[model samples]
Target: MTTTAPMKRRAILAFMLDRPGVLNKIAMLIRRKMYNVETLTVCKTTQPGTSRMTITLREDSDDKMRQVIKQIEKSTEVISARELDMNESFWREVAIVKLEADEGRLETLKRTYPFETLDSQGNGCFIVQVTGTSQLIDDFLKDAGSDSIIDVARSGFTAMEK
Candidate 1:
């Protein structure tokens, strides 16, 4: 017999009223259900007084996901909530990496990864911005080698339906 692992990532898109404490209420509800949020991005929408949220989590069952969505939609501030189909959606993340490298290594790094230099110092240090799928960012860091990396900051997944 073989056991299949549960889905490791799921995304929910929600439209809600832009008001104070709305996020807190939704977050608290999810927390009470014991679901761990992987990434959450909230931003104002084009509609006045409205906001859109993209929340990512790991869930094992479709029923549970539906229950979470229903619960979220019950909130006074929430207009609607639903799970996003990964296949029909596009996802992206942004990361800023600070590293130390010589002039020779810098050119090589640039050739390997598509990134914009945000800042640089004469002392062989540089800060660069990389935007792409999460896997690409991970690969860049892994290939860059840990010893040369000073720090990294990542903007969690932001998604949109196709």
Candidate 2:
């Protein structure tokens, strides 16, 4: 299957009180709205007492997404919240996929996926790193058929303030 629809990506930024359980509050809102999170990265901000989180949500209409953001801002632990577009901002995610890249297909895989040979010794395992837009990663997986994908770890969406 293929999609001609232009992918809609939104970067949601939140400044929350630096404390325990704040992450849970933020995640609950997304789950309640039934939106699948594409990526979620949280870290401390320059402000000594606050934490910043950037989350990327999968395909959805603008109005519905906006409603979710409003709910996030209304949370008691939330200091501020806003959604951003890729053009107006910059973000990156690291996808580490551990797969069985036997000697027969290593060369072909290197040519196709933007990845690095992390480890190939001892345990007969290899790790690949792919960094790009969500659509690109999604496309890569769709095309990477029958490769014995062992595991996939995405760094989620980490964005800089615009």
Candidate 2 lDDT = 0.79
**Pairs with steric clashes in candidate 2:** none
TM-score of each model, paired residue for residue = 0.92, 0.74
Instruction: Flag regions of model 2 displaced more than 4 Å.
Output: 1-9, 102-104, 122-124, 139-144
Q: For model 2, how does the per-residue alpha-carbon lDDT over 29-110 read when each residue is reduced to its tens digit?
A: 8998887777788999899989999988765588887899899999998999988777877787778877775765667766
Q: Which stretches of candidate 1 lie over 4 Å from their true place?
A: 1-7
Q: In lDDT terms, how accurate is model 1? A: 0.91
Tens digit of lDDT per residue, candidate 1, span 20-44?
9999999999999999888899999
Where does candidate 1 clash, by residue pair? none
**What are the lDDT scores of the predictions, listed in order?**
0.91, 0.79
